[model samples]
Target: MQPTEGERRTRLTIGVVAARSGRLAKLGDPLTFVTEHLRRRLRHVVGQGGRYELELVSRDSRSDPEVARRVTEELIRHERADIIVTLAGTRVLPAVADVCEALATPCVTSAFPWQVHYFGRGATRTRPFSWTYHFCWGLDDIAAVFAEMWAVLGAERRVGCLWNDGPQGNWSRHRERGFLPAAAARGHFLVDPGGYREPATAFDDHITAFRDADVEIITSAATGADLARFRHQAARRGLRPRLITCSRWLAYPVDGTGADDPAEAKVASLVYWTPRHPYRSSFDGMPAADLAAAYERATGRQWLQPLGLAHALFEVAVHALATADDPTQARAVAAAIGRTRLETVAGPLDWTTGPVPNVATVRLAGGQWKRGTRHPHELAVVSNSHCPGLRLEADLEFLH
Candidate 1:
């Protein structure tokens, strides 16, 4: 039921944090798009019903931990946010989660896989965090998509993994906890040189380990800069794998953009949400293709995967806010978000049947980047075995 004009106005202040500047700023583009789309949806729905007014207090994580913590503190202490939403990965998400949990605030997040989130970081599945909620594909989905891509490309099953101590990297490198089992289930063994620390200035030891193991395939869950460095260093050290699939090199500030070497032309990664997806916006039912084209037209840049996922973030947030018995109450909003089963522009998100509570997921497809005429290179869906109905737009192609 819509809140009537006679009813009191709910001042729903939302806290939004994203890595808007710094080394990781590239991943924060979704913050801009999410803000725009959320406002549009709110305006469309606010007066028509849910008579509450929306106020967003956005903060830039700056891709730094201390910066993220400080900004979140400001939002909660000064701005008085009713709920919070986090974007991107690693340093920022954990900081926001920690603060929100401490304050007993409802914090919703997307764009990062769940395995690297709270429960994925070694928390037991039986123990559910009350204040935070996440919706994204995890290691299980990535492994399935990668295995399906490998089979489609007819690549060798012997795979090598390079990951860092960070969220995605930690999950990828931990043998029992992550990729090893996912690959092992598909009859592929992952040669892990263990997790490495960033800014280490060298990866020669890791490169040699993969080469020594005769690894025919390479997979990683490193940052964009690290992935590029890994590829460059691997080539110089003569560690050329038949196929290289990665977890985090699929979007802007990286991905196929500004990539000079042909080495980057052949790599592939999991596609959580792409312009080719058949999903649409929950608010106005805007199609994925139209959304991408419009984003490119507005931003004068390539449409990214984060754009869709970020849009989904707001979709989930808005739904939770509107459904809450008391939008002004943090506890009610948190519980409402945990009960999310909304269809988003990215895909269907159901938090009920989680590997852990307060976590939901979307289907993942495999995509490869290559030079094309339409743009720098079109990201064609190369594998969709795990994601039914998402047709394969191109066969897997690798550099020799």
Candidate 2:
């Protein structure tokens, strides 16, 4: 079936690399929902020359770096994707971005802190990346939000630092532009037990250090499994901290196992995106709450934080394609993406006004998971110091 001579259209391929399987597979669920919604709403976009048909090609990274690299290369070389987008963390985003950089494909990613995405990838200020651009909150933002939560709780300024010896860990404990500097500036003393590797089932050593320090707060960027294990072990060892504030893992269901897990009770985490957000989607003018409600109604699952980010990814990508001088030209599309200044479901994103080139930082709030009527667990925004624009839904509660 060929198009009539009067109806010729250019096809633009948008590639998506996500961790659709493995431990981090839950991260891809929201992406799937957003992609499907966009497919129905954005079948074709009017560009410079004529109407352009948009095709979205998604590949599962399997939460493996090597697999991410392979799938990304295949999308570019075989699928001829014009742009690549992902909502993965350090594990897959870096791998996808590396391939996009080498292949000269425009890429957009969120979910991971911008610092980890930029510096962790060996990107220096002088040698800023041209093909890859990232938009997300930074370590400083999370640290400030965590500190605010601790302040609101009026707990001891003592924090038990728990991080894996990965890129996120190194950055979390870095002397500059890390959590330590931010915490010190905010007058919080963090008891550093050093870094541990992931899938670490035992935390006896770290628990002893935190218990010995009499730390009241536990801050970590641990995997769900490791965090649960650490919490269980800490409890059994009678080392109960006043608060267990974490990042990354709590954005999804508790341990990715589901919301019913009792371990998630009163666990605080970074609130990247939630229905309480005041922003609306640029595509449909849907309020953040409405979008979240729709997702819940459609999936029969509780709204996760990535849902807003996943929607924003498409909003930014589609804007770039539609505004490009020539949608078929990768450089032109990349230029449009670089010049993006649009308000999305997550919030306003302006690549031009960045903390650093190739990165636009968003704000983060503090949230605590508690018993809910709508679901087994619900994240209530408890602290909004870093994101003052977002309204606070509840007061910070302690795990103890």
Question: What lDDT does the true structure give each of the candidates?
Answer: 0.77, 0.84
For residues 66-132, write the lDDT of model 2, one tens digit per residue: 9999999999999888889998867778999999999999999998888888988888878889899
TM for every model, in the order presented, reads 0.91, 0.93
Shift in Å, residue 86, candidate 2: 1.0
| lDDT at residue 137 of model 2 (Cα atoms) | 90
Q: For candidate 1, lDDT tens digit of each residue in 27-97?
A: 78767766765665565224223667777778888888888888888888788777888785676788888
- List clashing residue pairs in candidate 2: none
Q: Model 2 TM-score?
A: 0.93
Residue 326, candidate 1: C-alpha displacement in angstroms: 1.6
Task: State residue 3's C-alpha deviation in candidate 2, in Å.
Answer: 15
Worst 10 residues of 1 by lDDT: 253-262
- How many clashing pairs in candidate 2? 0
